[model samples]
Target: MTDHKEAITILGKTIHLGESKELSFEVAKLHTFNSVEVPVFIERAKKPGPTILLTAGIHGDEVNGVEIVRQIIEKGINKPKRGTIICIPVLNVFGFINLSREFPDGRDLNRVFPGTLKGSLASRVAYKLIQEIVQEVDFVMDFHTGGSGRFNAPQIRIIKGSKTLDQLATKFGAPFVLYSKNLNKSFRNTCHKLGKPILLFEGGKSFHIDNNVTIHGVNGIKRVLHSLGMLATKFKISTPKTDCVFINESKWIRAKYSGMFKATTPIGSFVTKGDFIGNITDPYGKFNHFVKADNTGYIINVNELPIVYQGDALFHISKELL
Candidate 1:
């Protein structure tokens, strides 16, 4: 809780206490002289509390997070009882518009941290976010999804060695929690450097919205808010019966040969070493090649696309904590 009260400003607009507004920050301009902006939804409570930031659509194709954030806003999360909730439903406007994963310049937005004003499009946008949004938040939740043709089981990826982040992830109550190394130039690393706790939720697949994943994400956010004493009233926080599996390491199963692939095991399935994960058959049905797990682990991500090439990532397996 903060005793000192002051108005929050963004995009040159001042948001007073107990007020909520939809604002946009201009990030770039189009060839037609139109402006492209990042939409920000702010909800400041009448009472003081920790400020939490929730962002989605860092990769434009990841629509699950975008939809999750949208539902939270529609459910009136903006009308908080205490503290503030800042939601940026879509961060990469250019990628979102084109339905692509990265910026138009082919740079992954997630790989550019604390960007520079004079840098490329992705870098500039990252810079603006770091300067204007990330720096002010006490906590953050960045949502993500698997790449195209891959489905990731709903899970929380927390940074290693941060008890604060781990506790928040536990309160968030995702089915799986993985302690992952912070990637260089990623938002998670940048926030960690600034001494802010950030939790990343990876689920579903890019360009598609899975209802179960979306619902879980929405509830997880609320649970975290309640845990932080930012939620105004008490509501039944959803808890899964299955214990969350904590893992420190994961590996990907790659295709051994190119063919039309069919996965026999689904996402979230547990498999033993050498267990058949899928079978790849020639287009004409002349030959078949079986894909097997290299280690005993839980399948967190699986490729959904039927076509496969040699060395293509087919499954992501995470070793459960003993």
Candidate 2:
């Protein structure tokens, strides 16, 4: 018997082998009565393989991942060798326009997954994503960044379990690989329940693009595609000089007192317990207090904003594998 014709439908458009299409999923209506749509990009290869999804901007202000996806599409690097490649550069169109992390209803989009049809605006957006885009893929890569004033080192985070996902994270080749438990109602947890492997890449800072992080992200994605046999070309992937640091535990270094803070160590700095990470000083330059690391680890995220309050997360430290 001849091979069955391969076809996949998204946003009501059927894409056959070796075809690429752009479609929009209407998410909501603006105050001006205009439709807000989530743009989707799809590429299918003539040969059969695994379908993978790349999603970014769920937090809206995470611009590095958005730029990385845009560059991949603009540079024509998204052509798949086999199977399909689905890209959703911006999932929260409303939050993106407002430069906010939450929807107009003040709900965090990423916190409400597998949402409902008759729910609130955030829930409805999440529902559409799960029903339309997420259900169509076998694997997913969700890109994110440190919130607001924080900057993150390039890293890949995978929930515990799934050898396949671990291998994929290693292939992505980020400097750090974090194994953690999934959050309730988050995309990772939702996809895991559906038997799908999802890898989350956190890098840079919100609202601005970090070229270094963006380049690293693009290269890592290409390597992943190649490893999955989805890249159109047979090029050797470049391996990083240092192996990825695998960490199972991490903690947030919170400020003990509110003040104007200055960080002494940058993101990606290796630190020992009791190391002075930064110092907090009163606005008038009186009464200075230092913050020290409670555990030996690498700084994966650092708060960039000078102003701080007591108990604010100033640094995120992940234990380094020895």
Per-residue accuracy of model 2 over 1-322 as CA lDDT, tens digit each:
0123488767677888888899988998889999988889998888877778888889888878888888878876677778888888888877788888998899998888878999999999888888877777788888999986989999999977678888988999999998888999898889998888888999999988999899779988899998877776854567876788988889999999999989998889899999998999998867899899999999999999899999898999986562
TM value for model 1:
0.95
Off-target runs (Cα >4 Å) in candidate 1 are 1-4, 320-322
TM-scores for all candidates: the values are 0.95, 0.94
Q: What is the lDDT of residue 278 in candidate 2?
A: 96
Candidate No. with top TM-score: 1
- Backbone clash pairs for candidate 2 read none
Candidate 1 clash figure, as a count: 0
Q: RMSD, each candidate, Å? A: 1.6, 2.4
